[model samples]
Target: MANMYDHAYDLEKAIRESEEFKGLKAAYDTVMNDPSSKEMFENFRNIQLELQQKQMQGQEISEEEVQKAQSVVQVVQQDEQIAKLMEQEQRLNIAINDISRIITKPLEELYGQPEE
Candidate 1:
């Protein structure tokens, strides 16, 4: 029987070659290639990371911080290249989530699904 790790590697390779990955990569490249878009995208990503880190640390997110994050989201949403990149990213994330559910089916079957 083939090793599970080998199958996992194959899945990784397949994902890299998938259309969703290709679309996301292209969108990312377009955003990064332009100076203004690159800066805006990087700044937006930094803010998101900061908020996520704060939440992971169990710190309360201040109202000012929430407003700032919302403001940044509005700005990024208005940016055409960044908007496209975000849409592509969402598509890729959905595809990944679907794959994750499929891969975890065996464990779910063994343990049974949790009550909703």
Candidate 2:
């Protein structure tokens, strides 16, 4: 049964580690990626442990196991990176607005642009 269990681990690891599986997994890992979601991670960790145990055996996996795995993955999604990008965009917008404000300032300030 060791071989069987080994195959089970290998299969789970493969699916978990593969790029294609990751694309498929994005549906369930949103909170897990957040720095403040440690509880969410622990909660998902319990569910994931159950799933892994279910996976470690040759027994058929329940739909609940699959669902839990999907949900955990969703919790850990790469939202932080997206959030950082959004923050950068906001900063850029702010900088652009500041630049525009300066350019549109009183002509006396520019000593020019009093034309056009």
lDDT of each: 0.97, 0.58
Model 1 lDDT tens row, 1-101: 89989999999999999999999999999999999999999999999999999999999999999999999999998999999999999999999999999
lDDT (Cα, tens digit) per residue for candidate 2, span 8-78:
67766765675544543452344345556545556656876876776788678878778868866665444
Q: Model 1 — which ten-residue stretch has the worst lDDT?
A: 107-116
Q: Model 1: clashing residue pairs?
A: none
- The runs of at least 3 residues in candidate 1 whose Cα sits more than 4 Å from the true structure, single-residue gaps closed, are 113-116
Question: TM-score for all predictions?
Answer: 0.93, 0.33
Badly placed stretches (over 4 Å) of model 2 are 1-36, 78-116
* True lDDT of residue 73, candidate 2: 66
Candidate 2, lDDT over the whole model: 0.58
User: Which prediction has the highest lDDT against the true structure?
Assistant: 1
Root-mean-square deviation of Cα positions for candidate 2 versus the true structure, in angstroms: 23.4
